[model samples]
Target: MDEGWDTVEVPARGSDFLQLAVADVPAGGKAEWLAGRLRQAIADGRLAVGSRLPPTRVLAAELRVSRGVVTEAYRRLAEDGQVAGRRRGGTVVVAVPFTTTPPPVPDGGSGEGGVPGTGGPGGRGAQGGNEAGGAGSVRDAGSMGAAGSADVAGGLGWPGDPGDLTGPSPRERVGGPGGPYVGQGAGGPGRPYAGRRVDRPAVPRAGQGTPRPPGPYPGQGAAEDGQPYAGEGGGPGGLFGGEPGVEVFDALRAAPAAVDFTPGRPDLTTFPRAAWLRAERTVLAELSAGQLGYGDPRGAPRLRRAVADWLARVRGVRVEPDAVLIVAGTAQALTLLHPVLRADGVDAVAVEEPGSLGARQHLRNGGLATPPVPVDEEGVRVDALRATGARAVLLTPAHQFPTGVVTSGERRRELLEWARDGGLILEDDYDAEHRYDRPPVPALRALLADRVCYLGSVSKLLAPALRIGWLVAPARYRAALVDAKRFNDLGNAVLPQLVLARLMESGELERHLRLVRGRHRRRRDAMIAALAGHLPGARVHGAAAGLHLTVTYASEVPDTEFAAAALAHGVKCQPLSWHRQSPGPPGLVLGYAATPPGVIAEGVALLGRALRELT
Candidate 1:
């Protein structure tokens, strides 16, 4: 005989219920029922080994059962070595099901990411092939870019067809051997401020001369490197504080303020200097004499493997190493795709309104148009995206930039549907690892790798100065993107890639993320408290996770003016207006990761004072 049944109610937000449509389990045997369902899920491959189960409390509350019911159910799985608690990691599956054969990973499956590089079927490649590896190997080794913004958007593919790779590369296409390029890397093309970088050297391959030593690169010690933006008296960014234009990204970074609340920065003060130093030393000690010369354009195999494995463990992305194309940064990843998209007849990329202006600029730099789509509570409005008529769109779904809205499941399904109908997705998962509150969200690439191009970088967790990032593109674009990388600065400095690989493999990067998540959380709490006390009207968004928070208030004042006022009052930030091409609310993207509690409070107080003075 069964007891009275409990009403089945499951919360949608942050749920790990496996979306089972579980209406009712036998009331008397709820735990048993739950365990049985989970056991079958694992056995049949619906639940994978790295998949994380909901926290006992979270599951219990969602199921309208006592926490013990969930606990007991988990315990049953534990007894069978199916799932186990992972402390702060929550509970995760540990063993594969006893099936006749391994279960195929269905698309749009569990968002709970498993351990990276660990679960792929043993012999399969990231794209299940080998041509990508061969393409990545065609590098000019040791080719380095000069410190010039004008040449930053190095001509990827020549003026010929974007798809025509067999034709001359930028080097050959522009001018046969060592054409007229100066102050350039292999085949560098110039952008806005091109004339000023002429003093830098041209780095043709060994055929030109010994590979030029790495100096005068973008971040290196060039006359204009530190002063990214030069205004009256030469500030860190520039003197202009209001909604900055696309051209001033480097200058905005260079601008200085007392209490910088600028978002997207991880606590650089707490970077594991010692750990990095140790890793670099180890890399040097273990390096073969041949390795110090030039290296692979696909990035270090060790790093690619490390990244693939890491993604598998954490992001739930199923890829073999060869599929990974290492680049200077996500910035370069976007640039590399310019020709690829153009070749595919995509001249415009739909962007989320209130999206990263830098991304918009990069796309434009690639000679593509950026159409804006509105982002609501769910995410970039798919309806709006569809209306944009752009075949491709870029997203930061895990934790959207500035806005911080995770794309809801319904929206995700819509995105997949759109992709199936010929649309493309470029996923920039820049800060996915720094999540503090929610459990891991499975990457979209995990669901539809064939239609998505993924970008990730170490600039946040490690240091941006390292200038390292990776790209996982669909097979259609992989070879072209690799060629772009090869010609665009010769595949990032090899030594740093190897060092980062060591860190990822040795668990240093994960440890760093954990340390920073706690610190960033404390700072985030401080900012929220400060906002409540000082700016009563400011409604904070995207506070659930990420290194920053976006706050909106009902103010007629242009957010750019508000930002300028804040900067005048010894604080710095970006106005929400800067990210949105269309008019939106007056808000600020406040970064908390680098600021300490006391400093954050001081900055917010100053912001309040600045706003008061404005009105």
Candidate 2:
């Protein structure tokens, strides 16, 4: 009583795996409350794409609750495609579905803010209030005649289906209760009437309609995952089922296990912690105030120079520092280029068969169709590429996805010729620096600088959490691409760039690379050995270099189903079928870089068992 009142701290009880403080979430309806909060955050753009969420274990520990509860909450989000599981990489916020209903306004007469009232046709008052059906009610509507007039035109006349307003289709209404409505015509008798169609309301030609909304899903609202709906003719609901894309990485990361052989991940344990910490400290100590503020959209000069030097030394890609654009990662680089290339009148891009599904999805999301260019033992078939009319192509020339085949010299020459003849190449030199085989193949960017847009990142070398990568484009497209980058995120963080520069320039990155290469080589060999020993019919490809290997099974089982069965056995690998646009033999892409030899062996053994079970 004598002293000033002291504040009483409430101990936090974790509900969600995030170990969210009770203060962060109120009591009562906790799950719904937490879900709504997360949804709101996503809609408001608080959590951007590729944002890693706290592990369920850690979050559960913080909230003082069972891990299952957190997982369940995350699963709900996953079902809605709001979050996804990426094995080894942890849960990442890939997307958030956007759904916002305008708030109601107080009124007998329509409010002046242009807000439409929720009251139905009869001006039905708020629920539990009187249904204003009297003749005077029309007067009430007429009193605010101006506002009501617009509402009449816009209101319940089936507010244009967000899907239909964007495009037109050939499927006629046939005959239904909701007569003559083009797309959402009433189906069976039990089907709820969507809206009454105005018989002669100026229907346009078959292709007529508003321009499809610009997003992953053209002509429809952007699903949470940033893809568009498939449209009326395509199927029911919108693309991604009128929801967001599922967070694949997050779900995989949440799965508990001792050994994980998931692909495309580097050894995080080998990160140069001491070097990074030192670099961070040094950068912070010397950082100018201006440097701490918004930075050059292209990149920090120091980091770009460091990256240019590093690329020259490692990947053999020579470039001026001015040409380098720092991005969130290669993921963003694809997004930036997708629109650029599309605007340049390029409609389609050919990709390697059994390539990275994610990469193909990214290009398709940008509105360009991806034609599959078959891959042989050498690399993508140049002859096939010539057959496809795609003016641009995305390639993992250094070490191809799933199948680690480097582009052979002849094929590379053919590709260069194709590009020289006005084709464009989006080179994803992923995992090029981590090779253990023969001398490195020169990056396609090096040989065809004018036609290639090169992408590289530390996600496979250091950690994806860094969210750092570089893009080097031809001079003709550099400025527009930089503007796109600027509009994308105003450039990546400066401090991280500086620290990365220190790591690269000081040779800390090279040292780390040397260390991980040996470990990964052992892991890769162990996996190959396990495959040879256990699954004799399996053939390995791209084993000489890269963190992952593609193992093709001569058996008849579909690769996607094989992957699902493998997941059931507590082993996860991508089915070869998932990456192919054209039909091919089934296989799996297994990553060994992050796992130890013992774990790699176990995972491969599990895979062999899964394969046997399938057969």
Candidate 3:
């Protein structure tokens, strides 16, 4: 791990933020050098007690060091009890190691004198404004929200002062109480500098903000004119009642709720920031000048090959690297494919009665009709597909969205036979990788390659903001799909493709998957138990797999009314009717992945309260 610091260049790269240079060290191991400098700074009151350290990735990038080196240095500091990771909050100083004397600050030092409201020398914290700890040596977390502070400055003799792991943590000193401190753990993958408690107050995470009056947000419910808003009667409009529209999704997002259960989002707190930075750094460090120009329309070869290999190993889908097409997520995949399908004389794509509304919209936007096909317990009723008379069908076969039913083996064969009858299959294997209770179901594309256009994305596993996905089309449509992608955006940004390819190949992504599966499983169990206790007659669906579970109850009340009522009781979720083209039974899709088990139970209880009041 030693980078031969002995021969390292003088006046080595320094960060204006940290104001620490690699040249400041005594010329040895990179991690040791950085750790020693930070330790000395903390001990000397230069990196004062509560002033936060710069995020690992930010500092590493500025200093031109590998992310691993910075992580290693942070790990050592954590071991010495000098710092600890806060969930949703970055690593911060938990204790200052014993020092012999207070060292004088040099002429120019970025590490010295900055604490929130302290006006030390810098008059600002490391992150600036009030994000840093209290007046001088500790932050009054009350002002910052949720994450109350530990007054380490008051007593250096606190129970867990650095080296004593058996003692209570600093969080307990401020009233959080004794519990496991999983820094970089499954409970939540602590990103370096995830921010100080509130990512932003406007968002209002599960437990972050102060208690709100239990009711629908101001913008929701019947208007002042009061004509049942959208004729659904006495419930939230836009997203929660009547017909849902694309613009309503944004309104649903901006609306306030104490606990949110919107389906299809992963536990974003578990994102592997360190792994991503490592891959990104390596890709950039070795990138070629030629690779800097616009990339191949079908996506970079590196990512395509990685996807190919990854699919073969994980999903039982064998693919040649040349046949793979990188995309900007499943949305783009649908966007590019619709026109190609239209060009191929396919005018309508049949979707499951309870399917992804978003995908249906994309197909409709491309001037393709979306006919409805009913889905039974077995899966999308293939018999119904022939009734619709549509030549193409989009299916979430591996794990059906909102419903979580894996296509039965018989259903798969039926679909394969259907595909062979000159019908095209559009497979969205989005949640296939996150199954907990069942074995992997081979993608429909794997069974009948020529007849199926496969689509997959990391939106459910990684962050959706990445907007990266993969597609595989049969030989006939490959060129046309590539053309569509080329004209769409000249392919996704090449740098992210290379970085994602790096994550896929390095096995880090799989490791991340394993950690999150365990976390999600626990949360799912919590939701299940909460449903049983809170809602007596509720029936849970899709419990065997996927990020969300659907709950249907025997009642005449519309699901949207239940959803609007749930919002009034401090929970947010999607009404099952939103995904249906033809109405049937009422249900609510509840996502368990995005919340911890305790919060999941609370949110479900809130939903139950809302539902009970309605029914």
Candidate 4:
């Protein structure tokens, strides 16, 4: 009888059993029954080579059997060389059944070498030997059991089983260059065997599923250069094409490149996790019950005051806290201003010709006409803006984006005069705080507050994920902007606003700014050095400060085509043409802040190689 049969009872909950019919096993054979089932599972491939069996104690509890019963059964499998016990990895299957044909029998009768532990030569009866002793024969017979079917070596593709590859496997169809996993054919390295244990494949680890090919180009399935080719004519697929209103931001975000140099991205790796956590805790500890309610749409009172103080000290712009309104970012500031500007009978806004494409898209999306004005070394040509007849203009004065040209004193006076004469200046001091060699430039808003609606955000100073920014609108439009913000998402989440206020007032943000400046300066220097060595002919721009720099080249090929070629060579960056409405020299907008100096060098070197190949 089974040793534990008297003491252990099957729980009334269920009668769970393995492949073996324990109930049919003759009285004392339960342990032997379990062992027989396990051996068959391993041989027939129900359990793969690396698959772990349940722990002894857990399996014992589940089967309502004594722990010793499961342990003994596991021991039997181990002795047969079918499984092995790893310290913490549990018991794992190690070998498959000896399905391949065995060595031919000796000329004389089979003797000592009778498949170790089996009934010597006689137990090989199925292969021609006679039965020696019934007891030992029965023992050998029980060991092989259902697993013996695998020894026959034929058809039947069981789940998790590595079936006989006698015929073409399904993997053969999706194997070579024609398939997604390009360059790998059936039975080739890194290819999975059909219906086999996934863990056995040399490719990506078990549960990750089929790995996606690098870069998702538009219409094409996969590309050799790892860049997703959307369609012919260099247009991205799926709603991104040569259409005038094509969404560039969405398309670029959808197809992320391996070595990206997309501009305006900050070094997110340096965000102060410890400091933010401490501030968060401090804010929560001092937070009152009343403060949890819907906050002031203009922003939390604490943050507004902090913004006013910080701006006065750093930006040289003085304003009462009441004039400041917290927003999602400069993006939201534009969103809220759209309605306010429209109410003031403004239907069109003039943007710099080679300006931010994303900004232009947002303005157009808000139902405003954006006329392009030419930008020269002095910044947006005041003469060009007057000709366009756009009463309102959006300009990045502190650090002109894409091309970092500061507004000259002559240009500033001209803009102030234009603003005084009923023109609205929407100043985006986007990345002014990151200046390296340039002296601080007072914001256009500081000169003419009533005409210029200034926007600033923590996106470059801190992390964009925070979605925190401050907008100081002219007094006349402040209330209207606040109302627009209130109706759009009931103001930014309150707790983060509070935490940010702590960082700003406590000087933590300034310290962080200092830290990233040094890191960015080094990276900038590295990129400049790399560009000099690799892309000697390429003209680099805006290297003094900011997260990105522009490189213009006097090449025969169009900038967009060149960008596509670079992407094919495992590099990603935006073509300057993407940002400009009016034509100019072809260039690429490359960002270095987020990438380490080493990666920046490698990426630029690749660009040089790709450029040379194209030429």
Error of 1 at 151 (Å): 46
Error of 1 at 420 (Å): 0.4
lDDT (C-alpha, whole model) for all candidates: 0.63, 0.58, 0.63, 0.61
lDDT (10s digit) by residue, model 2, range 271-325: 8889999999988999888777888999999999877766644454546688888
lDDT per residue (tens digit) for residues 1-615 in model 3: 101212111211343223343334344598998887678656644444444555676567546778898899999999999988775456767788776664442212221232211112332222111111111122221122111123223311233332111123222121123221212211323311111111111223332322211111111222233222222223365446544544456667767888989888898988999999999999999999999998999999988887776765456455668889999899999988877876677876878767887887677667666666656555678876876567889998767776665666566667767877888999998887675444344566655667888899999989899999999888778889888888889989999999998887665776577667667766776777787778765656555468987776656676777888888887889887677654345678888898877787789888777777775
Residue 131 Cα positional deviation in candidate 1, in Å, after optimal superposition: 42
Q: Which stretches of candidate 3 lie over 4 Å from their true place?
A: 1-235
Cα displacement (angstroms), candidate 4, residue 35, comes to 89
Runs in model 1 lying further than 4 Å from the true structure? 1-243
User: Candidates' TM-scores?
Assistant: 0.67, 0.61, 0.63, 0.62
Ranking by TM-score: 1, 3, 4, 2
What's model 3's lDDT at 531? 75
RMSD of each: 16.1, 28.9, 23.6, 33.7
Top TM-score hit: 1
C-alpha-based local distance difference test score of model 2? 0.58
Worst 10 residues of 3 by lDDT: 192-201
Off by over 4 Å in 4: 1-246
Tens-place lDDT per residue, model 1, 433-526, is 7653344455778767778889999888877888888999877687888888888777778888888988776656755665676677667767
Clashing pairs in 3: 133-139, 134-138, 134-139
